[model samples]
Target: MDTANTMIRYVSPINPASFPSLSILLLAIGIFFMSWFIVYEVTSNRFTRNLKKELLVSFFASLFLGFGVLFLVLWVGLYV
Candidate 1:
């Protein structure tokens, strides 16, 4: 008879308590950028659109917002 042997590994999750400042910073920056993007969209003239600038702003806004929310969710002890 032969027996199989297997090894188990343990992985640790990120601890939000370790970097609370980072979480707050990301959230703030995300909110600021999102607000700026919204304002720009509302005030800019459709006929004189700057695709490059608009794209850049929107990209940063979404990127930061996404990360920010993710961090916040993790920080709140809600693992998903």
Candidate 2:
């Protein structure tokens, strides 16, 4: 019973101001993994080579795309 109480008490709520950074980090990481997975799966085609290049491209693409959308939303939120 005491152990269960301590486990439940260990959780804490997140701060609202911290949300933007946390959200961006999580979104970017998720996008990176998802893009990598897609690229890997598509590479199964016999005609396709250069797996490293494909993975690198996907990584940077997702990174930029995630940050781009994040800034876009922040900019829009400022005006509206």
Most lDDT-accurate candidate: 1
Per-model root-mean-square deviation over C-alphas = 3.7, 9.8
TM for every model, in the order presented, reads 0.71, 0.42
Question: Candidate 1 at 63: error in angstroms?
Answer: 0.9
Candidate 2: segments with Cα more than 4 A from true spot:
1-12, 45-80
Report clashes for each candidate as comma-separated counts: 0, 0
Model 1 lDDT, residue 10, Cα: 52
Q: lDDT tens digits, residues 1-80, model 2? A: 66766674443355446546765775677677667767677766756657686677667767766765655465445521
Q: Between which residue pairs do clashes occur in model 2?
A: none
| lDDT (Cα) of model 2 | 0.63
